[model samples]
Target: MRRYGPAVLLLLTGAAILRVALFTELYLRYVQAGLRPYLVGSGFLLVLLGVAAAAVGRREREPHGEHDGHHGPRIAWLLALPALALLLFPPPALGSYSAAREAEQRAAQGIGSFPALPAGDPQALTLAEFSSRAVYDSGRSLTGRTVRLTGFVTRDDDGTWYVTRLLVSCCAADATTSKVEIREADAPPADAWVTVTGIWHPKGRLGTDGAWPPVLDAASVRRVAQPANPYERR
Candidate 1:
């Protein structure tokens, strides 16, 4: 137990941190949507399990330099799985997963509040500039025109799938997701990086929060692998 103590602690700590970070918004949105009781209970159970493991591991110790040769490497290797999974298959952005949960937030905030800019030189465009322009421009200028975009998969309430591009100024902590709905016969799996060439059509519908919603109606959608730069423009 002692031989594997550090490894277990490391795995738990890393998992807790990663889960907390990735699901922070989900947790908050769940609470805001009045579904916290169920999620909280489940989350507490996980925490209790982690605590029990830690406690048991603390009660045993390996003699100095006398490694538990059989279990040490196995434990260490198991501890490496999470990091490897993260590298190989990073989690997708919080899109439709939280779309319903955040419907109230979206309604209260409104999409028009997003910054906008007047058309100018494209060469001087930054990500912020492009995003702001894209948000405000109503996709009208680009309507019926095929444009390329890369993002992870997200699903809406109607079971409609979307390719969501998260724009981040820094890290995933502050990422804001922008989405384009895919009109395909079969939806792709969530969290898959995809490059879509689609004609943008702006339309509004009633979201779950009973607010007016605007989204890009995609003409085409396809699946692809992750890019070298998984995170979008800073």
Candidate 2:
């Protein structure tokens, strides 16, 4: 027990830190709402359990006449519980889930309406560049212009199609999806990689399922192969 104590402590600390970082926003929100007293009560109980475990392990170490380097009961397996929970009850990917939530928020807040774009040489822009620019200033820069975007086809329940891009924090486990509607004469099948040329336009009304309204009046849709890295920028 003594020999493995340091390793177990390190593992516990690492797990706690990782969980805290992943749910930082939730923690901040809770803290602001004066619900921290409950957390404090529960935290004290965990601290007590940790102290008790350490004391019991220390006592057993002396009775066994084991050296500091002796292998103790395999407590390491206990670490798998949190990992298993994360796997079995994983968070939803940032696709329809996030989009629906955002659309609802936008509807309630009356936001997301972009200003008109000034006339310019639209031929100078690529889809990736346009999308990046729109991220910083979605309103004025992307409005009223025909642009081309290439991505895999994704569909909503209403049968409308989109060219979807996934923005990932690390891997698919934490990916978030954004999309542009395809209104071209020829729309590609779902999951097919395609390039779409479209005029940027605001969505009219919320869909029944409340997807983040798309922003393209597509002029063309042509199938292509998937890019090597399907995820968008971190």
Candidate 3:
């Protein structure tokens, strides 16, 4: 019975991760939405591993998790911490703090050759795509086109403001941000959710970072509620 305790706990923990990721918004903090299947698979695998271990241990009648006197069971118990944390508290999405800590890298690598925008008055785009266009397009595709972007607000010390979004490679731990510096608009409070419609201004460079995405000349800024999915999938 004692041998099965940890295994049961582990199985429950795995199930919890799967449930929260699937039925709730908690998964976005760690992975892109496209990874839902993989996360669920991983959670199921963990549960299976734990159940198999318990079954084998029961058949062999070996307690202490092994013949050896090592602290293997104790170490195994530590694996439950992530699940416990998830259940007790909601994981936070990457925000300005995470963005500020990382170096800025917003150069338009290949967006210069991007095909023409879809037929629309103001094309809607993810912050990453917009950043790429701003830095790489050089005013050809975006010369007069009004673009719409949605992101939380971030501020620079020099009275500059940015509309920002995080792009996650795998999780918040490895998140990179996309930002567009805004001009001629009142600086919204930090972390405010807003949609900005503006024309691209090739002249406004964001920072000392080598990847200088274009800035925006804001025509209107509309504050909105924070989105359910906070980060863009990379």
- By lDDT, who's the top model here? 3
**TM values, all candidates:** 0.43, 0.43, 0.76
lDDT, candidate 2, at 24: 38
1-234 per-residue lDDT for model 1 (tens digits): 534445455555545444533455433311232444554455556556667767766766766777655445544556656754643454654554543343222212223433332444222232233334344443335434445566677776588876665555545455555555566335777776666555445543322322122244445566786654444453
Error of 2 at 198 (Å): 1.2
Query: Best to worst by lDDT, what's the order?
Result: 3, 2, 1
Rank candidates, TM-score, best first: 3, 1, 2
Candidate No. with top TM-score? 3
Q: Encode model 2's per-residue lDDT on 1-234: one tens digit a residue.
A: 444354445445444434433443232211222444454455455445657666666665443454545555667657656644543443423444444333322112223544555466343343434543444343446666667777676677887877776654444554455666666455566667787776766544333232344567777677786654455654
Candidate 1 lDDT for residue 62? 64
Off by over 4 Å in 1: 1-135, 204-219
Alpha-carbon RMSD to native, per candidate = 11.5, 10.5, 4.2
What's model 3's lDDT at 225? 86
TM-score of 3: 0.76
Pairs that collide in candidate 2 are none
Our model 1 lands, by Cα RMSD against the true structure, at 11.5
